[model samples]
Target: MKKTIVLVTLFIMPIVVYLFFASGITNFGKLAMLTHDVSEIDFADSNVALADKITVLGFLGSDVSNKKGNAFNLNQKIYKRFGQFKDFQFVMVMPKGTEQSVDDLKAQLGQLSDVSKWNFVFGEEDQIKGLFNSLGTNLSLDANLGTPYVFIIDKERILRGRDDDEDEGVKYGFDTSSVADLNNKMEDDIKIILAEYRMALKKNTAQREK
Candidate 1:
């Protein structure tokens, strides 16, 4: 009986640990959704060595029309805070027609603050659909789901988290009403992620000095 109990405990221990850390499991589906390599994106042209840059990729829905101000505000905050780290870049990808033109979006972003360090990429409806679908983000442009969904991608091209649980590969409908809250939540989450990156950089720098 003692030996049998020990075997059972050993078998269940890993399951318990995995459940505890399940949320940190990397989203492989989201990682595959990236259509263009961050290093090759046009905005990265001048900075080809983005491997050293901490990159954030945000995806907004088609319904985010006329909400340019909100988007700009969030991006501005992230840019200002993350810019403190060298080689850090933030890229906002949105579907076309939901907001204004790429230039208009850039202008709005610029208005928030001097956002010259960031890049804005505009995707047509179909292209955006493809991008999201590849990442398992289940909202469709035809369904009238507005923008506001966001995803964070690291320099290694791993998607940290998605706004909707369904987008994270779980079974469920996308939450339309949660976009605004997600916008707010993401702003805070990005800061934490940047801090983690900074710490990792510091550790590497210390190791080199030694």
Candidate 2:
């Protein structure tokens, strides 16, 4: 009786494990690009460009202090993980006059992690609107010209996100205020996009070797 029970337990365990993982597979092999050729020309007073890098883009608006919590949440949850990866960057688009506000935010975030990849770019109101409009997302900037949401942009200057997100169907951005969104959905999408690029790089290298 003991041996039979042991055999049955072993037989059922693998099936249970497989089903658990199968149920959790939400993302497709690659995250679909929702917006193409997002403008990169509006960034000012900075050397950062969105052309050939994976960027987590955000807008802090004029009242930087109000968004401090959002920034901390993002830095702790997302930036700390992928910030230092090659060609990965965090770009916060701020209005031109608020450079000091950006500096203060940077100083605080610096205590938490090495924020060398955190690039703050200044832009005029019109320029900022032009850039934001190019994203084609349903999201809008707030009264101070900021939103609590941030988006993932790929190397080709395209916005990458889920087309069949269970809640929104077309998830254009992740809310920094929600840890669950960052952990469960955003992180998985990030991993998928990174893997896609890495695979392409490997294939190119193999072709070169041949």
Candidate 3:
């Protein structure tokens, strides 16, 4: 009777463990690490606080004359989903004096939601390029034609890449590619990162309580 019970328990435990993972009960993956740190940006004309914001950053300069790109619509969707978080922002880094163009672009896109959360910051060419380099992205100010890659930055100024820390999808260098399934996949990463931040906060709070 004892031998039969032990065999049954062993068989059931493996199946239970497999089902737990298969049912998405556990996410063993870690959140994406910061590829690089960003510096204090010299805003063109806004006083928006840089700290404590989850920013989706993009570039628009003489090289990137137009504001329309793959990131714009994706950002709108993200804002609709997560803008109520208050600290979330979509930052468009453009050249000084192109604020009008950005506004026009926003209007063109129908301004679906989170208009206040969309920050259009402008700076000189050199300042914008330097900021991009500091973030460890392979963006260029000299390229006449290139795709503006979007970056997800956390409150602590670390660049959050695709998925979690160990995933190969993380961007390490200059990448002009955009995700084909931009909305759903990137949104999932953003949620995971947000959850990670919240978990850290809870852990810190618990420590303080003790």
Candidate 4:
């Protein structure tokens, strides 16, 4: 009995240590702020004011493929979920040559474009790439084709990541067809940040009154 107990304890000890470190590694921290002091990134329609509101920034390519449309479609789904709120905005940045597709893409909204809330911006390849790098977002884009990641930039221009997702800051491909994982995770994260912001505002107001 004594020998058996000793062997079991040794086996369980390593497992316990492994689980502890794994949880710590996956536990998300507060949203990360910009690595540099450039302030805000400029879009074609508006120079997205960081301190103004929460921004959901997504990227689309000009390639004749589904990746670009997948990212846009995901954005559409996100808008349907939170379009009525004026405090948030979704901006989609695409390659410059595809600007003509704006009309067709707008039809996907099933409503008129709310330029203030839903903006479709474009720029030269270099310009777009520069914006991504400036914000400390890892983007995989080229002259006409690339797979980019979606990022949540808070009011203070901080890049928000998940509290339990290890890859929250890692750039990955967007595929709306499989909406359960990526799309839902992002929507939930947005809600979490919005709630945190509201709570902070309330606290500030109370302090001011006191």
Candidate 5:
């Protein structure tokens, strides 16, 4: 009888673990479904219009304790380099539970004079998760969870590059190196997108002259 009881316990443990992790993945997929295009979202400040061309949006998960992570540095560098592109906009979305407030974030960004050329958006945890989901990226839902993610969206609303951290259609299995390579490739991809936008802008301008 004891042997039977032990066998039953062993059989049930793996099932329980699988279900727990599976549920978390499902929840993330649901959250991702809530994301809408940036053009669809109304920016509180009208001076910064919705990008009509290619846009690069980076997600930085900042904590009050450590404000200088690689994510922050990457954003600062990108802003300093390309913040002035008329057809390209760089947006940084902060994770939830960060010590910084929207105003505080703005103030911190103010230290970088070039930062004024771009827009800084304060994102709610759920909304940001939805954006990740829309890009097909999965982020931890916990209050303090953060991930470094970059997304490139074209004017036609097409999402280019791998969005989710997980392998497509597979649950829980992640390729860390693949994600890192994708992030690195984003800088080059952004340049290509910007060039396309510039060409389109030139075409539009020439047509208007005619």
Candidate 6:
């Protein structure tokens, strides 16, 4: 009986768990793509390597100092957990002349976690607007080329976000100012996307092996 139970638990339970998620009608396990081909902007003074990377993209306004609390929340909730992933990165675009402020912000972020993958790209206001426009999102940049929202960009530069959001109908970006939103929604979505890639990689490897 002991050996039989172990066999059923190891084999049958795996199939049961897989089928449960596979049959989910909402397909909530997978993150939805909101925009396609978010062109990587080359005009930045400091450009992040966007090709073939999973990026958490944001725009920090001219007054980076004011965003300290939001930045800390992101670092603690998102970056700290996912920073170790090979292709995962945080790309924050800032209008030109925010370099010193960004550097200071980085210093503070580094105290919390390894901020190596935290990339800050500097660009003119026009350049920043151009990049943000390519996202094809309903959101708009503030006067200083910043918003309280940030987004998830897949390897192909496509925007991944919630489409059937109960509150917003079509959720485009994660709000930085809301810790509860980040903890409850954004973190889970991040996990899904990362797992999605890992599963794809595993499938590709298995195919190659076969």
lDDT winner between candidates 1 and 4:
4
Which regions of candidate 6 deviate over 4 angstroms? 1-27
Per-residue accuracy of model 4 over 1-210 as CA lDDT, tens digit each: 998989879998878745533443344334344443324656576665556678777666676345535645665666666666657887677787776665466655545334447667777777777767656544455556344456677776667664334554453323345566545565555556665676678799999999
- For candidate 1, write residues 1-210 as lDDT tens digits: 999989879998878644433322332122122333333344322443335566654454454545465565556555665565666676655555544555666676676677766665655656555545544444443454234444555666544553344335432122224555434444445555565665577799999999
lDDT of each: 0.51, 0.87, 0.62, 0.60, 0.50, 0.85
Could you tell me the C-alpha RMSD of candidate 1 in Å? 12.8
Per-residue lDDT tens digits of candidate 2, residues 1-210?
Answer: 999989878998878744433333444667888999899954576578998899999998999999999999999998897786799999999988888889999999999999999999988888888999999999999888899999999999999998999899999999988999998888777777776777689899999999
Give all TM-scores, in the order shown.
0.55, 0.86, 0.71, 0.68, 0.55, 0.86
Assess candidate 4 and give its TM-score to the true structure.
Answer: 0.68
Give the local distance difference test score of model 4. 0.60
Q: Over all chains combined, what TM-score does candidate 6 have? A: 0.86
- Candidate 3 regions off by >4 Å? 1-28, 62-65, 69-71, 139-147, 162-169, 172-179
Question: Which portions of model 1 show Cα errors greater than 4 Å?
Answer: 1-52, 60-65, 94-100, 123-126, 138-146, 162-184
Which residue pairs come into collision in candidate 4? 28-163
Candidate 6 Cα RMSD after full superposition onto the native fold (Å): 5.1
| Candidate 2 positional error at 38, Å | 0.3
Stretches of candidate 4 off by over 4 Å are 1-39, 43-48, 64-72, 111-116, 142-148, 163-177
Q: TM-score for candidate 1, please give it.
A: 0.55
Per-residue alpha-carbon lDDT of candidate 5 for residues 106-208, written as tens digits (9 for 90 to 100): 5666676545544556556666666556554444533543454455666655555433534454222122224344344444444455555555677999999
Ranked by lDDT, top first: 2, 6, 3, 4, 1, 5
* Arranged by TM-score, best first: 2, 6, 3, 4, 5, 1
Task: For candidate 2, give the lDDT.
Answer: 0.87
- Which ten residues in a row are the worst by lDDT in model 3? 20-29
Candidate 6 backbone collisions, by pair: none
Q: Please report how far candidate 1 places residue 162 from its true position, in Å.
A: 7.7
| Deviation of model 5 at 72, angstroms | 4.0
**Deviation in angstroms for 115 in model 2?**
0.3
